[model samples]
Target: MAWPNPFRRRTAKTVSHYGYTFEWTDEHLSEEDAHKLRFTYDELADRVLARLDAISPPQKQPPSATATSTTEKASSVESEQSKPASRDLYALLRDNKDSDPVLRELWDQVTTVPEWVDWPQIGRGQDVFYRYGGPNLTGLAYQALLGGMGGARVVETLARTGGFSIKVARRRLFETTQHVLQVTRSLDALEPGKGEGFESTVRVRLLHAAVRKRILGLAQARPSYYSVAEHGVPINDLDSAATIATFSSTLIWLSLPRQGIFMRSAEAADYIAMWRYVAYLIGAPTDFFSTPSRAKAFMQSVFLYEIRPTQTSVLLANNIITALHHQPPGYASAEFLSASARWLNGPQLSDALQLPRVSLYYSLLMLGQCAFFAFVSYTYRAVDAWDRKKIEVLRKVFWQVVVESRYGLEGKTTDFDFNGPGLILWGLFQHVVRPQLHWSEISRCRSCFKLLPARESTRMYGVHALII
Candidate 1:
């Protein structure tokens, strides 16, 4: 069944979102993309798992059938149905790339770069993440993950995994954060076969496949466990597209502006392009983010079309805020987190999710942060040296991440231990302090307003206008 799209249209192809309207080509969301919900990554990761399971079947086995050659393919299908949880696609690729045809093909497919990819642009894109480190971190934490609980499919899968439960929500948040931080570590880090970014991304794909495979098995054995018809296959293309969009488009347009930080035209394109490459590697549709405008439209469409906040959304949102409360000395507070949810997601969705009200303390902190970020962003954008210095400080704060293996998969796990008063102080002031004001006019002021009342005052005022 095709999931109804609010933006799917024939004539005008325009949709209203949060008081703004966006128009995209009919190519944006096709019938094929819609039905992709019923499918997962079958060609590579799924195929590799199917083969590995039979070669090394689980220790437990069902009674052998009396039949033989006539049912060769049938038995392969049955073996897959009750296969081992996974054979560690990454390790299997490492151990058997030369010996296993399927694993070799899977590795080859992901490592090869498409003709459209610009290596230099990809390198620049990696820099964009760290360039505006504080706002991006804030956006991912407050808006992307927490705000994303409104999705029916993504939220449902996360709920089943218990990753977002109060007990492990904090760990879940850091685990995800670590992947992002690692992926954008450096330009060289993104090169296929050599970079950790490429390796991490491929490993992450297998984890998603594992979740889908496990959940599919559960649903088959107990039909009531999950309704594929209703919820779509776990982490399908649209969901994957939405996941990457949350990290890219949402941060560029919605989240950063909420903190009074804005990207230049080139900066915005580079950031979107960076995530587009990630989408390509993970089997998500890359065309959706081919340009800055297209990426923004995709995010707006997902926001209006996909967000259907239920009680589950409310529970997850609260869990996220509570899970990160008082994380480190002077680092974070409930007042800040609640206010951030209210600010980043807007009052309507936040209220729908039943997020707590923003207290006066939250308001004052937001005010202080907006003014500070605007100053910082403008000051650095105007001077190259100052920009580097700002990024250095911001990097030190978020770079305090630790990588760990979980569920018996190396390079497939992420955890963070945030401590130390000095680190906490810098991180808190930089990322923990929340900002809610948006200043769009400030973004273009350098070119728009150069002439002013006085000569010397004009340059400084022009810089200030860029931050206003």
Candidate 2:
């Protein structure tokens, strides 16, 4: 059913950007390259084969080890050759559709790959994330749409942390912006260890692992408050992780197209492919959706099956809007943020989050901003090479506003004071009081009423346990 993109033009041609010309086709990749793009069978099969060999190996050593090895290799090659040559996921998905009725039904009426699966262009046009007003727009979109609607469990966790609220909100926001930028850079390159290796890969991995550890510890300490059914299994399970990851991948692409920061079908494919690889590295399940269309499907599934907003969702959204309102540069206002939330999430969700109704002035300003960016996004490509300096300045200007937002308010002060007895007692409770509950055998299962893990001493439990 799928071949050579028959739905599109097939005439041999050249396209040029920045004096560079390249062919556009589904065949941009060689067969070997396509194989490289997908998963490898040898890795998975090796583990199962190794276990089988250990249990059922020949008792006697071969008389000639070399001959036995050669025979084994020959058999392996014969088995491989007898099987289908194409083992890539796309191929496997198609081949298994008949036997796997579910797979067939899932993709049953789907055709032509959504008209937006242009991988080649996406790969080459990775600059869209930062070059246009992508950072601001996406940051806004996340606050309004993804974070606003993903239920109480995820947002409530952030709210209770108090890390970004009481301790150091400015620093947290800066770190978040940096993380977004780093991910953008990594996606542009889209290789495991390329371009800011630790920043791109290890940083996020460690952050996610630390988050998991902290959540597990919290659940263990306070079963009454946090539990599997409430928080979702594994704390950050496939569904939640997929939602969070797609916010940056598919959601970003979806948001940008309206603002004139558009990506071709192939460009969207490359963007999603980059994130899929990143999600794998960070230990998030990528099996749900390997393409943008599938990601969109996964998103739709979220609304129908996953999300159920509550009081906690409202509190978290309010917290996010409040924090953004205080940040420097003075642009993110209550009215502005609420209006953007309303526009992005629609009236129903906006009401769910309890966002104030849109203000006329802010709404018009936001609209103007989008229109201006759309103009720039479309026209600037012709002058992109020559406009590097201006683009850099624009990037700097955005960050400058961000920095000002961090520390720019009048009468700003960092001095914090609390009652002396209350302060000392709270410290004692955190360091001295909390430890007793943590070490107590009875306290271990006080909330959940389940057996605690063997290594409880090594784990810490408290609000400050996992800040990063």
Candidate 3:
């Protein structure tokens, strides 16, 4: 007899995100206005978009904050910023700060640190990631991206770029991990003009611009291909803002707590601050993610605003799991991934994405997995002697254990190469060397107490970060 196709549609047309969707409005703006901005894309990156002769710059129609006329995009042809394309963005900013009008203006904007930024808190925030590194990563892959497939509009843009395509899933995952790592690599990694975080974030900004232009070009070529009126700009401001929330607020409110891990109020705030700076650098609307409460509300408001999954959502979600099966830091099976995705995202959303049902064995294994992380987290949190300095030590340990191991994976990298301009190579490890860590560890960590299975020289799934 023939088997069933998990990719087949599971009737998600009427489904909605089960989470509470709050109405978002700050003192300065209303929900109605934010909706208008939702259809908007970044305008500052228009100059870089002009250089690509292969595509036309997207016109944001008329009478909107995001609206950019073709004449304005074409006007860049005469601007000095459109000179040689080979010059790296960082070096261009350094060497031609005086010459490039675009970089100069952006430089002044991003470099001037906001008075509210608290460096010590940011440092502790970095620790929060590594503090529960394993479960947090599981949260990222299973909850943030895979479960995030519910956002139909975001998936619309992702589908257009073939980003979550079966072949590109691991690359996309690792690249995102690297961006998180770089920005949180160290307290000083965000030092405006001279840090890895600063440089990489800016590169991502340019990449976002490029993608927006590419899609806008496609929509322009074939009107039926994409609807700006219906879908908004390629990567509109709301989309970008929501993207940042997935990495931060989603982790704090949804991903971590669901896995039996929870951050204290302070840790949550600092973590939000780290991503808030990232929002600023990436040109996402920042005030929305300014504090823990604000970020949570924005995330909830976004779920209310979007989260209607479609057939494409099912395809992309399953495709990511299939592509990354038996691969990477977590050499997880499709069943293992589905189980975790289901747990982290709950049954309602998982059902909408058409995630296959796993046996109770996998569920118990997940329970064991959460128990292990809770042990580690509880130990760390209970250690009264473990001060901010200990957190710093933990950060270094994470750098050595996880980050260092990732570097030489098939001679890939323990560090990012900024010698180039684009963010294409951010997730190069998938291509450079795809190491099969320890998918067995998911089971092992679950059964570590009783069975004590012999760990194959590699590490386990999400339990890669050993507190030692």
Which tens-of-lDDT digit does each residue in 41-125 have in candidate 3? 6787656335332232233323332365788767756683854333244444455556556657777877888887888887778
State candidate 3's TM-score.
0.76
Q: List the residue pairs that clash in candidate 2.
A: 116-265, 117-265, 118-265, 118-266, 118-267, 119-266, 122-267, 327-405, 328-404, 328-405
TM-score: which candidate is best? 3
Score every model by TM-score.
0.76, 0.54, 0.76
Global lDDT for candidate 3? 0.66
User: Sorted on TM-score, highest at the top, how do the candidates line up?
Assistant: 3, 1, 2
Please identify which of the two predictions, 2 or 3, would achieve the higher TM-score against the true structure.
3
lDDT, candidate 2, 1-468, per-residue tens: 001232454356543321112344442323343223222211222232233234333133233433557778788687965743321222233455465544354224222223333445444434444455442344334432334344554454554444335234444544444444444542333433334422234333433333444455567888864566545543254433444444444344434643436665665566566555545544455654476666554444334333457776776566556666533323355676666555555455567667788768766755655565555555655575734543454444333333223332212211111100000000000011011123343233222212234344542232111100
- Model 3 spans > 4 angstroms off: 1-16, 19-31, 48-87, 384-468
Residue 241 lDDT (model 3): 87
After superposition on all C-alphas, the RMSD of every candidate to the true structure, in Å, is 13.1, 23.2, 10.6
Clashes of each: 0, 10, 2
Off by over 4 Å in 2: 1-125, 135-149, 163-170, 186-197, 249-253, 257-262, 382-468
Residue-level lDDT of model 1, residues 1-468, one tens digit each, is 011346656467676543334566653555455556446444466777676666665344223333446678577788876754534456556677788788888878888888878888887787777777666766777677777787755677777666677776655555666667667777777888878677767777766666677678889999998888878887777788888898899888887877777799999898888889988877777888999888887787677767788787788778877776765322456777787667777776777788888778786676565566667666776888876665554444344322332211124453121110000000111122324212232223222222323243222223233222
Q: How close is candidate 1 to the true structure, as a TM-score?
A: 0.76
